[model samples]
Target: MAHLRDDSRGQLLLVAGLALALVFIGLALVVNSAIFTENLASRGETAGSSGALAARAATEANAGTAIEQANHYNPSAPVDAFNRSLRNVSTQTEALSATSGTLSNVTYAGHRNGKRVSGAIDRTNNSYTVADSVERVSGANGTRGLVFNASDLPGESTPLVVKVNDTTATGDRNSWRAQIWETTSDVHVKTFRNGTSASENRTERCSVPSSTANRIEVTAGLVNGQPCDALRRNDSGANFWFGNGAGDEYDVHFKNTNYTTGDFEMVVYSGGGPSILLTTLSDDAIYDAEVQFVYDGPDVWYNTSVRVAPGEPDA
Candidate 1:
């Protein structure tokens, strides 16, 4: 009887050992699977982040190219340029993304120009998202520009504030002027040429700072019976009759007033639109400009804007 009991105990011990071994095998498989899952997740995150950044780069390049192309178009007319840019961006998006739907459409807005634009690029199984946009950055160069045509600001009675800052480039080439006239102010002229000069009958007159080193800040309003004045010029072309010669290059930097905005800069503001006076000095010579368009009632000007940075934007 004792020998039988011993044999039974041995069989029980062998069964328990087998069960323990099976449990260990099952545990090993679970641990291995967990590690593999973690590794895959890490890799996927890294790849997605990289792809998103790449997409941003592609879209930004496209945006900049569009803006340059737009710049060559009619500076007065911006819609055509915007359309052209949108088309180019579409082509760029195609190159950047695997699917058309994955990339976001390009868009733009501005008062006087298509100065600001936006878009997005997506990549890699939609694992991550990349957004891109571009803005017109001025002041990098030492020049500024603005325009106020016939249609920009219509009515003549609106008040205006004309401001000017003097630069060291005076006398021989320094030019700062404000032109004004009523029914007698309009001057009939043809295309501009070098040494363009005209003598207008006594009605509207032109004014420029005699002191090249002086700064000017004047507002034209219906104080007594006079409307606000603006940065004005009647003559066009190099060596204009209105001047001691040379173009009246005003700084078109409106927002920044520290006078540190550009190489030679000035800012002009007017409640009413600016009067029409073409740049008589029609040389390829670069000059800063500002334009105020008269839409419905209030005049509109192109607001300055910034573009996407090389780094990631804040969410």
Candidate 2:
């Protein structure tokens, strides 16, 4: 009986040894699995971080390209290209779960060395952000001649301020001459020949030479209730005569009763003769002539005449 008991005990010890080995194998498998899982998690985190960084970089790059293109090339082309690139980047980033993570706050910012540039940003769900700015740049050659056309004249008696830039050497503002033509009979022309000729008789009388034709002639300068030597000579051309050899200063003023129908035309001249011909007439004959720039040691001067006319005025 004792021998049988010892055999059973040996069999029990072998079974216990087998059970211990199986437990150790199971523990080893568990530890290896934990290590593998940790490695996978670390790799996923790194991939996600990289994707996010890539998306950010793409956004910045697209913004920069768009701004640069707008400065040099056509503004629309670069803007469109930038918008497309941004959309592409946004789409790609949103699709990548590893990049954006659980946050949905994805945005693209545009700047030039910390200075915010003008552009348009399109977000999700058709939402967008836009920024714009305007800058004026001057020309290198400066201003040319006085830019005057038939669009800048005054229509009423509103007080106007005329600005003149002296680009020429001529200091004499009165050197510039203007030829004015009256269209109505009520409007009269007056000329002042120095202070010695009296002030009241500065107006020149207008008369109809022939009844058949509507030709009007201004003959003889009114001086102190008498006719002066300055006469409207019909010898050479149709022009107001200021004496044969008169070197005196003259100031001409036109007065009209009706401001609406009263019309006149004028052209600027440099020396004795007129420069440009008076082809057009203004309804309200009121103009101010000022000297502007002069070129080549004041030999040629640029002048601007602002006429307040009835209709649309010229600049």
Candidate 3:
């Protein structure tokens, strides 16, 4: 009887030890599983952050396109038209993102009013007024989206000169000018703070070696899609933007218009109406828009505000 009791006690002790070992194994498995779940969550958050930034960029691009379309097609009520377009963009973006198990959206916040003035610079050689008494956008001190598309520019002797005259001031000392011409192998844009006399005024020049340089984005500071120092912000106090240093309002005139052959366009923000020289393709167009973007993923949520101005100069 004593030997049987000893064997029973040993078996009972072994069973307790095995049970404790099993409990320890279960705890380890639980801890490892928790660590793995945390790692997956972190990875998901990182991917969501990247997706949000990409979505914001896409929203800005789409908003810019919407503004252009509204100005060109719904000039009478561009702001209202732009908002409608934004709604469609939001719906499309959300639907596309759903395929990736995410939600993204773009919502219109607001817009700035302006006019899109476009047309031939001049069919004849006669100089004429491009716009008169055009005021700068209320908050900003300059105009935007001023571009020249010249297919046939004359030589320096008869270059096309664009002048910006202060409404309340006159003379070479108070105006900004851009003289454009082309040579056998290059196209040139000469900017003047006040007058065309290079020795008497602050002047700078930008030239492109390609004979096919036709596009000149003036306010955006690009020549033939290349950066040009003459048209951009300069610390020397001479910027070629029409409204710069021109007071509250200015008149845009083309001197020797017959020197260049092409179309030009610009947008001015003001309460005044468009000049007859400009077709006023859009009376009350939206020049820029602000949008709110949102992105939602399994492990992250992001929201941001972006302003879309397609041709505004780089800050």
Candidate 4:
């Protein structure tokens, strides 16, 4: 009876010890799991912050590229290139983050002279769109603004407008006007015919009176019946002839014009002592003008500004 009692007591002790060992193992596993979960959460937050910074950097780089392209002879191509570059940067940054299981959102925002320019992107679904809300502040030349939300991830869209401004104009005329000539060869020259003979003549080449060099041709001859011929003339000679008569007045008109090359300029002042011309990419018409992007930020909480300096030609 004593031996049986002793054996039963030993069995109970062994069972209790086994239970305690199992319990300890379970507790250790739980603690290790908690630590792993905490580490993962911290990594995710770090990724989000890094992603935002990368996206913002890409956005600003794109804006700067677009602005520099605006100074190019063929702006459309460069502008297109600029957009592609931005997208590429976005993709790369997203890929970098996506390796860690995070998605990316890239966008564009544009502004000029410190004013908010309207911008948007339409997704393939056609039911949704992302829009940029821009704001401006005072700058060296004038008011300048930063662009935001210029692009959307998971969708491709074009800029609503390209930002351009004239820094100079040269002419006796104080008022500056922008013109869009359809063809590269549309520049017009006026030939004066002798009153009595067809042989006597002086050829005057007339171009759109703006600081920029591209000539713009339109169907209409004048604005509000006010003749541009009177206001526009080459400083060296009288290039434009004004009058309803066929020979007395020559109207420069462009037919079947191709603005695809994107060679154009922004005339800063209309009638003034000297005109400053801001060069831009090629565009079809003055109506196709757009604002360029300069800056972008995240958190929707910080105030930012952009500075535009005249780009000079390479020596």
Candidate 5:
């Protein structure tokens, strides 16, 4: 009877040990699976964040392009034309995001109205105003979309000078000026801004070969179709696209326009201005736009509002 009891006890001990071993193995598997799942979720979320940001950038860029194109197409009915163009842009961007396994959408929220002034750069002996009493878009900080196309520009002595004068500026020291001239081989863009005093004055110059391109996109900060350092940023690290230091409200004027033969254009953010030498007719245009952007992906969701203003100062 004692031997039988001992044998039974040994068998029970073996069974208990086997059950504990199996339990430990099962628990280990469950813990490892949990850790792996958590890691996967973290990685997925990181990727999703990147995708969302990329989508946002694409949407904004496309919207800006669409706005410019729309203005060119239907300047008479600016807002309606921009809406139609924006819809097409949104649809294309959405499809593009899907290819990367992300979902995205862009919708136009609204726009600001402005005037598009364009005409010849051919004035006679004296400087003249292209647009007077021009102001930035209501509530906006600056102007945008100033461009010039010219050839056979004269020398610095009687150059084609463009000025943005602060309506309230007391003297030339407060106005911003751009002097366009040509060397034998290159076209030059020189910028001047005498902030408040002579010591605060700043000037910069950039040049491109005359044979390259005839376009100088002032607000866009390009010369001969290439980026120009002088028009982009001033010595103080402030953007001087059209002219810094001049108040947001200013007058656009041309000096020695005969020195350069070309066409010029700009979008004055103000409601409307009296027709001047350069502009015979001012077209209604969309100056800027607002849009909503949305993105969704594995473990991530993003939504934001973006303002699209092409060639905007410091944009």
Candidate 6:
């Protein structure tokens, strides 16, 4: 009986030892994950900043070439030439950076913008589609709307904001006006042409919900006009499939139909700027970019998006 009791005590001690060992192991794993996550965030920021700066450099260096090529462009036209030029610049920059300090597995997404002036690159085709964005116009006609690529906006959510400043008018335009709406399909837009009732001077704003459709349509008219009802998904003209409702890749557009004599700037934002462009992806237009970084140790990846416009710089 004494011997049996001793064995039972040994068994309990062994079980306790195993439990302690497991606790230590679990602690080590948690620490490792925390460290890796921190590394990813910090390194991702570095790669993103560097990449954005380099992209800016490349864009500046290649703008003239792109324009020169576009002057007589045909076939794939200037877009093909433009992309090639950007790729060349990105490749050179990547090589230089990697050798100097940038991360590896750093893909030179010299990925083509597919002639898109401003948009996010599709993972499927590697093309750009600008979404959840805003644009401003310096000078304009009675009708003009900036088009953004589509994204999946969460249902009944207003993750996007459109702000227009048409009040800065002079001469033949004393009355400032603005109108914003969305569309799901490519049909005739009537909000910003000939005669729209923006005769009163004011600033206009609206929140864009992800529900009701896949596209943001615009005509230049009343802020709450019948055409604007498309926001409700009740409009037969609206193609609700405009967005997938997945909470990514949602497109936002802005329209101005009454600013014919003065200057105006329309800002579309989910609440941010930079890492993007307005009309073209050249020179001063190369506003921001998304930099992808991969770390092999522990197998980690980080994608850092940076906008250089508001002064994000390396430390």
Best candidate (score: lDDT): 5
The TM-score values for the models, in the order shown, are 0.29, 0.22, 0.71, 0.25, 0.79, 0.26
Judging by lDDT, tell me the better candidate of 1 and 5. 5
**What's the residue-level lDDT of 282 in candidate 4?**
16
lDDT: the better of candidates 1 and 3? 3
lDDT tens string, model 6, 208-258?
333322344332221222233322232353221111111222233332222
Give the higher-lDDT candidate: 1 or 4. 4
Model 5 misplacement above 4 A: 1-46, 137-140, 234-239, 271-279
Ten contiguous residues minimizing lDDT sum, candidate 4: 128-137
> Residue 251 lDDT in model 2?
21
Which regions of candidate 2 are displaced past 4 Å? 1-7, 44-49, 60-105, 108-315
Q: Please rank every candidate by TM-score, starting with the best.
A: 5, 3, 1, 6, 4, 2
User: Candidate 4: where is the Cα deviation over 4 Å?
Assistant: 1-51, 76-85, 111-274, 277-315
lDDT of each: 0.30, 0.28, 0.76, 0.31, 0.77, 0.34
Per-residue C-alpha lDDT of model 5 across residues 168-228, encoded as one tens digit per residue: 7876867888898888888888888777779877788889877534788888888777888
- Comparing 4 and 6 on lDDT, the stronger one: 6
Clashes of each: 22, 17, 1, 42, 0, 23
Task: Name the best candidate (by TM-score).
Answer: 5
- Residue 185 CA displacement from its true place in model 3, Å: 2.2
lDDT of 6: 0.34
**lDDT per residue as tens, model 3, 1-315:** 345588888998999999999999999999999999999988888877887888788888888888878887887788888889999999999998999899999888877667788877666757887777876655664457778888888899988887877877757656778887888887788887764344545778888764454888877788788877677656675565544555567788878877677888777765565353555433666766779999997768998888787777543
RMSD of each: 23.7, 34.2, 9.6, 24.3, 7.1, 18.0
**Between candidates 3 and 5, which one is better according to TM-score?**
5
